[model samples]
Structure formats: C-alpha cells, structure tokens
Target: MQVLFGYNTNGGQSVQSYGYYDPNYANDIRTVMVAVVAQSHVQTPQQDAPTKLQLIPAVPASQSITGESLPAVYFYPPAGSHNAQFTVMTTTVPVMNMIWH
Candidate 1:
C-alpha cells in the first residue's frame, strides 16, 4: 500500500510528502489527474473507474466582476470633505483561503 500527496513550492525549497514509490515513478508513467471536487473526496477510493477530475465548487466563482464591473476592492480619496490631518483612510481585504491539494 502507498500513500501519495503533493504541494507546490517555488524552486530550491524543501519537498515534503509521505509515500513509498520513488518520485521518479511519477515521471515514467502517464499522469492521472482528476479535478479536485472537495476535501471530502480526497479519501475516496480511486479504483472504481477511470481517474476523473470533477470541478466541484470549492470556492464560489466571481459572478460580480465580468469585464463591465469594478473589482471587489478599490482605493480612492473620501468624498465631500477636505481634511487637515492629511492621513488617508485605510482599506481592508477580506480574508481568503485557497486549498491546493
């Protein structure tokens, strides 16, 4: 039995994974790529059928911006008043998490 996993790093960084086969095995055989649907799917057995990639809704696609709309974030001066302290208002970004598995 073997367990394999992957994570990306820029080059020259430490490689971390747990498995038995040589990393070179990945190069000799054709790759089996499947669309990652969700975290729950990771534990699924892979032998039932052809290795498939399912595009599950991990994160909602951005429907709001589609060439005609402004981006979710923007910065500009405040309206209607001039200030003497000269400090610009700060902006905040919504926290985002991307699961690369």
Candidate 2:
C-alpha cells in the first residue's frame, strides 16, 4: 500500500484524513480507513457558565473529493470521522502527452 492523499485544517476544530493507494492502478483495492477526534474541557463556575456560553461558536463543515470517480468526504468541525474511498490511479493516454483544461 502507498500513501496517496492527505488533508488537514488550521485548528483542532476540524477533521484530518490520510489516504492509501494500491500498486495495482488498473483495478480497485480494498483498505481500511480510520479517524480520531479530540476536544478540550474547561472548568468554570456556575455563575460564569451562562456568560461563557457565547464564547463558543458552532463550526462550519467542509467536504473534499480526490478524484471524479471518488466519493466526497465531509468534515464536521470539532469532531472527526472516516470513510472508505475508491480511486483510480491510472492516467488516460494523451495524443500530445498534455492536457488543456
């Protein structure tokens, strides 16, 4: 197995993932993917809890796709998740060995 993709966020409020590809680019390969999420805890007095609630904000989510045939990966801020994705590593033949758009 070979590493083919990697992604991350600015802070721990989002998820991160890594992808592994197989040597056989012509056919599909099976592999397992995993993700771990961590959050911090703060201690505050009962009186301060109400006022401090506004300090925390809901995080926006994002998505990523490695290739057209691949599935989209959704990122939920703060907590992370994982999923399996199938991708093709082969390239199409080019007449001039180049691509335009």
Candidate 3:
C-alpha cells in the first residue's frame, strides 16, 4: 500500500490520517474519483462509541491529482474515556464516477 498516510497516535487521543484524494474535492464539480486503503488500525477505546467518524484527507495543496501526494487528516470528536484509533481504507466514489460519464 502507498505510504501516503500518517498518524499522531498516543495514549490519550489516538489520531489516524491517510493520504489520498483530498476531501475538499468532495464537492469538486468536475472531480472524477478517489480511492485509498487502510494500512493500520488502533484498538478502540472501551468508553467511546464507534460513531461514523472518518479520517478525512486535508484539502489538496494545489488540487493536483497527478504527481504530488495528498495527505489524510484525522478528525475525531472526543475519545470520552478510552482511546479509539483507526486507519483509513479505500475512499472513492465509484458510483459517482459512473454519473460523471
């Protein structure tokens, strides 16, 4: 797997980030597709619920889909009591691509 992902995990706040298509492009009208796979995962905290949280990739520096890389950014509400960590897997819109065509 590509090593575009990164993490800032620790004892208290476990954060996982991946590198792939940026989320800012999530609304890009001309956008075509996006994909990424989870390389690692941290155990979930016993106190926090597994809500629908996601490791959204930061906005592309220059919105370049070629050559340069896009890094993922973790964004969690609160661990509550325990620490919950997870890696980002494939993140793309295949169905969306169909519509584009």
Estimate the TM-score of every prediction.
0.15, 0.19, 0.27
Worst 10 residues of 1 by lDDT: 58-67
Model 2, which residues run further than 4 Å from truth? 1-30, 42-68, 78-101
Name every residue pair that clashes in candidate 1: 34-53, 35-53
Q: Judged by lDDT against the true structure, how good is candidate 2?
A: 0.27
Query: Clashing residue pairs in candidate 3, if any?
Result: 18-72, 36-89, 36-90, 36-91, 38-89, 45-83
How far is 49's C-alpha from truth in model 2 (Å)?
19
Best by lDDT: 3
List model 1 lDDT by residue over 1-101, tens digit each: 11222222322222322122345433222112222122122222433322322222121223111212222222232342222112223222221222221
**TM-score ranking of the models:** 3, 2, 1
Model 3 lDDT at residue 4 = 34
User: Candidate 2: worst 10 consecutive residues by lDDT?
Assistant: 48-57
Instruction: Give Cα distance to truth, residue 73, candidate 2, Å.
Output: 1.5
lDDT of 2 by residue, 1-101 (tens): 11223233232222243233433321222222333333235433332222111211222233222323333333333222122222223222212212111
lDDT of 3 by residue, 1-101 (tens): 22232222221122223234355433322322243333224555564544434455454544433334455544344544234544446443222333223
Going through the candidates in order, what is the number of backbone clashes in each?
2, 1, 6
Of the two candidates 1 and 3, the one with more favorable lDDT, higher being better, is 3
- Residue pairs clashing in model 2 are 13-78
